[model samples]
Target: MQTFATLRTPQTTGLPARSGAGMLLMWLGIVTFYRIWVLPRLGITLYVDEAQYWTWAQQLDWGYFSKPPVVAWLIAASTALFGDDLVAVKLSAILLYPATAWLLFVLGRQLFDTRVGLRSAVAFSLLPFVSGLGLFVSTDAPLLFFWALAILALVRATSMDRWRDWLLLGVALGLGVMSKYTMLAFGASALLYLLLSPQRRAQLGNPRLWAAIALAAVLVMPNVLWNWSHDFPTLRHTADITHVEGINDKGGNVGEFLLAQLASLGPGFALAFLAGLVVAWQQRRDGRMQLLVCFSLPLLAIVFLQALRSEANGNWAAPAFVTATVLAVVFLSRLKTRWWIVVIALNAGLMLTVYHVRDIYRIAGKPVPASLDILKRARAWDVLARQLRPIFAAHPDAMLLTENRTLMAHLLYELRDMHLQHAAWKPQAIPQDHYQLTTPLGPEDLGRSAILVTQSGSAGVIERFSSHQTLAHVSVIAGPKLRREVDVILLEGFRGYR
Candidate 1:
C-alpha cells in the first residue's frame, strides 16, 4: 500500500519508502518463527501460574478462581494435538504473537502516517514486556490480542459509523472480557467516554452502538452465569487477592510499579509515550486524538487509583502500554533520523540485556541466551520433575500430590504424558487429581502411599506429614526473570503400618 509515508517528499510522507509494508511483514514473520519454534522448544518449562492454568484446561471450566478459561482452553487445544510437550503447551500464544503485531499495524496506520503505522508494529513486536508476555501461555496474550482487535474495530466504528463495525467492536470486547476480567476496565472506560464526550454520546441514540453493547453482553453471559453458579468465586478470588489478603503487598508498590513499567518500556520509548500524549492533545483538535485519549485515560485513572489501594503496579493498566507505544512511534518519526536511530539502539540494547540475563538460567540449554544469571531465575521444580518420573512410572497406582499447579502440571506431563508407560492409565484419583496443598489436609486423608510433591517455598504446610518419607531430593533454577529465594522441592511419602 503506497501511502503518504512512501512518497519521495519526506515532509508529506514523513517515513522512508524502505520502511514499507513488505519490510514490516518480514519482521513480523521473523518474530513469529522465534516465538513459536525458538522459544517453546527451548524447554523453559512452565511457570507455576502456567501450570495452574494447565490444570484448569484439564477441567475445562468457563471461568476459574483468578481468571477466565480462554487461556486454559487455548493451551488444552494446542497441547491436545502437540502431545502435551513444552512446545505444544505454549504454541498457541506464539502463533498469536504475530496477529498482535498486525493489529498494532492497523491501529498505527489509522492513527498516524504509514511510517508511524509500520513503526508501531515493529515497536510492539520488540517491546521486551510485550515479547515476554507473548511467549508465555497466559491470559495476557489473548487479552492483548482481543483488546487490540477491539481497538481496531472501535476505530473503524468511530470513523465509518457503520453498524457492522460496531457489532465487531462488541464481539471483540466480549471475547476480551472472556479472556480477562481486567477488560471490564476497558468496557467501563468506553462507557465513560460515551457519556462524557458529546460527540461520542450521540452514539447512544444509534441502534448499532446499542447493538454492540448488547452483543458484548450476550457473548459474556455464559461466563457470567458460570461464575454466578460457582458463587462468583472469581470475583471473590480477585477481591481477596486485591483487598482482603495481603498478597497485594507482594505484587508491587506504586514506586515499584512505576519502576517496573519504566524497565519494561525502555526510558526513551517511555519518554516518547509521554510526548505522544502531548502531540495527540495538539492533534485532539482532530477527533482521532480524542479517541486515543478516551481509550487510554480511564484505564490509567483506574490503575492509578488502584495503586493507591496497594494494587500491583503491573495490573494497574497494562493495556494502556500499546497506546503508549503507538504514541511513541508518532513522536519519534518527527525527530531527526539520528535521534530516531538512537531510540532504536536503546530498544535493541534493552532487548539484548534482557535476552542475555535470561539465558544464564536455561536449564535445558538455550538456543539463544537472554543473559547471564539466568539460573538465578530458574524454578527448582524442573529437576525434581525429572526425578519423579521414573518413581511414578514404577508405582502407577500411587497418586502424586503437589502444593501448586506448576509442579502439578509438570508431574502430569512427565509421568502420565511422557517417559512413563501408558498401557491403560485412568485419570488421577481424588486428592491426586488437582488438590490445592496451599490448604490443609486432615488425618482421614493421611496414611496414603502418595508422592507428596511440595515446594520448599511452601514446604511448611507439608512439614507435618510424619507418616511419609522424603524419597528424593531434586532442584531446578528459579527463573530468568524472578528472584531465587527458595528452590521448589518435591517430597515423596509412603504410608507405613505404625
Candidate 2:
C-alpha cells in the first residue's frame, strides 16, 4: 500500500515530519492556482446541476425546492466578485476544494500527527473525483470544507474543552448541513463516537456539548423555516428520493455502489481503504482508532445499508472520506516500499485520463466514443444555448416557455442578455422543480403569446393555444453517439389548463 509520497509517523523520541507540511502547502497552492486560472476556460460547459444552481443564485434565499441554499449562495458570491464569466460562476469550487484540503491537513495533524496530516491532504487532493470536481463546481465543495472543519473542531474541543472550539463545531456542522443534507451523518457519527468511548462518555451530560448541538440546530432553523413556509418542498423531495417510509428492495445496489468505489478511488486505493475500515473495526478498542472508525465507518455503513435497502449514490458518503483518507494514508504507509510507485502511477494515470481524455483521443487519431466520453454532459450545452439564442432574441416579448428544468436553467443562463424568465408549463398543476415552483404558467397567461421549447414533443399543443406552430427544431450533435434534440414552438393565445 506504499505510495510515492514518503509519510513517516513521528517516533516518540525521533524527529517529526515537519518537511511534509511545507510540501503539502506548496502542492495545495499550485492546485488552487491552476483550478482558479486554467480549468474554467477548458471548454467544458457547466453541468445541468451547476446551471440549475446558478439559476437558483439568481435569487438568493434560505432554501430551494430540492436542496439547501449554500451552493446557490456560493455561486452568487463568486459571480458577484468575478462578473458573469464562466470562471466567475465556477470560482467557488475552484477555491473551496483546495482550502478543504488544507483543513484536512489541520484535522489530520490534530487527530494523529504532522505526517498523517500531510499524507491526508495529498491523498484527498489527488482523489479521482476531486480532479474532476476541480472542473465542475457543486454542493459537495462547501460540504467537504465544513465537514473537515467540524471534525477538527470536535477533536480539538474534546481536549481543550474551549467554548470557541465548541462554537466552531456547531457552526461548521450547521453550515455543512445547509450545504448538503448528507452532513446529517456527522451528527450520527459524533453521537456514536461520544457514546462508545469510555473516557469521554461522562461528557454526555456536559452543558457545553448540548450548547453546541443546540447552536447547530439554531443555525439550521432558518432553512427549516423556509421549507415550512414553502410547503416543505425540500423535505418532501428528500423523502421521495430517500423513500423514508419504506425500502423498495432494489437489488444489487450495494454491489453497484461498491464497484462505484473501485471506479472512484481506483482499485488499489479502494481495496486498501476497505481493508482499513475492517482494521478500524478490529482495532476499535484503541481510543484513537475508535474515533476514526466511529466517524468514518458510521456514515459509510449508513450509505451502504441504504444501498442495500433502496439505492445510494456513490458520492452520498463523501464526507466519511474526510477521516477515511487519513486512515487510508496511515494504512498505506505501512506497506512495502516498491508498491509506493504503483499507487502513485495508478492515481496519476487516472487523473490524467479524466482531465485530458478528449486530447488523448485526438492525439490517438480516434474520436472518443460517446459511451466512454465523460465530458458529454458538460459538452453541447453551449451549442444548445447558441441555437436558442436567436429564437429568444427575436421573440423578446414572447413569454419564454419550457417544460424541463434543464432547458429552463441553460436557456435562462445563455440568454441572460435578454433577461428571459420562463413560464414553466406544469401539466400536473404541481411544482416538481424550482422552475415550476416560481414560474409556472398560470390562468393570467391564457391569452399571452409564447415561445415554447420542449425536448419531449410539440404535437397536440395546438389544443392549448389559439394558434400553435413549430418555429424550429434544434438537433445538436454532442459526441459520436450523443445528440440533443428539442422542438421550438410558437404559440399564440395560450388557453388555461383548467
Candidate 3:
C-alpha cells in the first residue's frame, strides 16, 4: 500500500510537466463530446437570439439592424448543412471552440512555457463560459475565437518581429471586427500596445501594421457602408438598449459585478484569474506578459466601471478573463504539484455543480419551467405555428400583422421549412413577407383582409386593429413563462371601417 501510494504521488505531482499535453487534450476531448454531441442530442433549442440570428441567415445581408452579418452567414451555412436544425446551428461554433483552445495553447507556449500553455488551454477548454457559449451560436463565439487568434498573432509578432505575424494579426483583427463591433476594444488596445512598447514601437514604423488595418477596413467596408446607408440605426438601437441616453433606472452594484464574474468563469477559475491579475499588477516589471496586462487592464477598468454604472453586459469582461487565465497558467506553473491538483479539483467541482443545477431538470423528467411568460410562447411555439398556418391559408391574399418583430421572427424560424407561411406586416429591417400593419394598412394592402397575430403582452396594440373586422379568434395557447394567449384573428368579414 505504501509503495502504491508513493507511486501515485509522483505521477500526480509530475503530471503538469510530464503529461500536461495529454491531460489538456483529454479535457478538450471531453468538451468536444459534450458540446458537439451530448447536449445537442438532448433537444436543446436555440435561444431567442439564436433564432433571430437564424432569421438573419435566411435574409443574407451585409449588416443587420443590431449586429454584423458574420453570425448570420455562419447560421445560414450550418442550417444549409443540416436543414435548419437547432443542433446544426449550434455545431457551427462548436467546431471553432477547439481551434480557439489550440490557439490558447499556442499563445501560452509562446508567452511562457509548455506547461503554462497546457494549463491555460485546459482552463480555457473547461471554462463554463466556453461550455455554455460553445453550443449556442452567437456573435461572441466567433468574436472570442478570432480575438484569441489575433492576440496570438500579436504575441508572435512581438516575439519574432516578423512582418507575416503582423499581417496575420491584421487579418484576424478584421475578421474579429466582422464578428462584432465590440472587437474595437481589442484593436485599439493592440495598436496602443505596439506604440507604447519600445521593443515593438519599431514595428509601428513598418507598413505591415497599416496594411493589416487597411485589409481589415477593406474586408469590413461593405458592412460599414451598409450601416452608414441605414442611418446607423443599429448603433441607435444598441444605445437605447445600453441606456446611454435613455432610462437608467438600474445602477451597477460592485458586489453584483464581482459575483457575476465568479458565475461566468466558475468559482475555481475565477479565483485563479483574480490571483493572476494581482500578480501581474504587483510584478509589473515582467516584460514578457506586460503587454497583455497593459491591454487587459484598461478593458477590465471599463468593464468594472460599467458594472458600477449599470448591469454589466455578461461578455463585457471576456477579454479581461482571457488575460487573467493566461497569467494564471504562467504563475501557477511555478507552484507545487499538490497546489495545482487542488486548483484542478476545485475547477472540476465548479463545473460539476453548474451542470447539476442548470442541466438537471432536463434529465430528471422534470421540464424546466421558464421564468418569463415570453418563454412559454417559445415553448408552445410549434402549436402556435400550426394554429397560425390555416389562418394565413384561408386569406390567400391577406397580410399578417405583428406588434413585435422578435415574436414574428420566432414564428418565421419555426415555420421556415413549412410551405404556407403567414407573412409579418411590419417595417422589416430584413426582407421578409413579415410586415407591420400597426399604422393603418395602405389602400392597396387593405384591399385584401389581414390576419393580426399579437401576444397577450402586446394585445393592447390590438386597439389599432379596431378598423378591421374580426372574423374569428384562435386562442393560441402558450405555456406558463409566456402566460401568453397569442390571438390569431381573421379579418375577412371587414365590417368595421375607419
Best by lDDT: 2
Q: Model 3: residues >4 Å from true position, as ranges?
A: 1-26, 41-43, 253-255, 342-380, 386-396, 419-444, 457-484, 492-498
lDDT of 2 by residue, 18-103 (tens): 67668887998887776666565456677888989998999999999899999999999989988877888888887887888888
Q: Which lDDT tens digits does candidate 3 get at residues 1-498?
A: 011122121223333543666766777877777655565443335566777788778778888877888899988888888877767877777877777877777676656656667778877766767766766778888887888888887776666657888788888888888888778889667767766657667767767768877888888888889879867756666676566774358666667777767766777666766677777778665555576676667787777777676656777667666666777666676677677677767766755554444357657777555551222333455565677676666676765656566666666677675533344544334432212321234444544555777654433434434345554555543543343356666544332224
TM-score to true structure, per model: 0.81, 0.94, 0.83
After the best TM-score superposition of candidate 3, give how far the Cα of residue 135 lies from its true spot, in angstroms: 1.9
Please tell me which predicted candidate would have the highest TM-score against the true structure.
Answer: 2
Q: How close is candidate 2 to the true structure, as a TM-score?
A: 0.94
Model 1 lDDT per residue over 1-498, tens place: 122232212325655544667788898888777666656434466766677677677778677767887898898899788877667777777777677878888777766656777878888777767666666777878887888888888767755787878989999889888998888777776776566557667777878887898999999998999878767767776776567454465553677667767766678888887787899878765555565666766677666656666666474477777677777877888897676677767876765555444444445567433354442322445665666667676666556655555455555654546533211111222222223322223344444445555545444534544544556555444444443222323333422222
**Model 3, position 194: C-alpha lDDT score:** 67
Choose 1 or 3, whichever is better by lDDT.
Answer: 3
Query: Which regions of candidate 1 fall more than 4 Å away from where they truly are?
Result: 1-11, 14-19, 40-43, 195-197, 244-252, 313-316, 357-380, 418-434, 437-448, 456-467, 475-498
- State the RMSD for candidate 1: 6.3
Candidate 3 or 2, higher TM-score: 2
Tell me the spans in candidate 2 whose CA falls farther than 4 Å from its real position. 1-18, 36-42, 247-252
Pairwise lDDT winner, candidates 1 and 2: 2
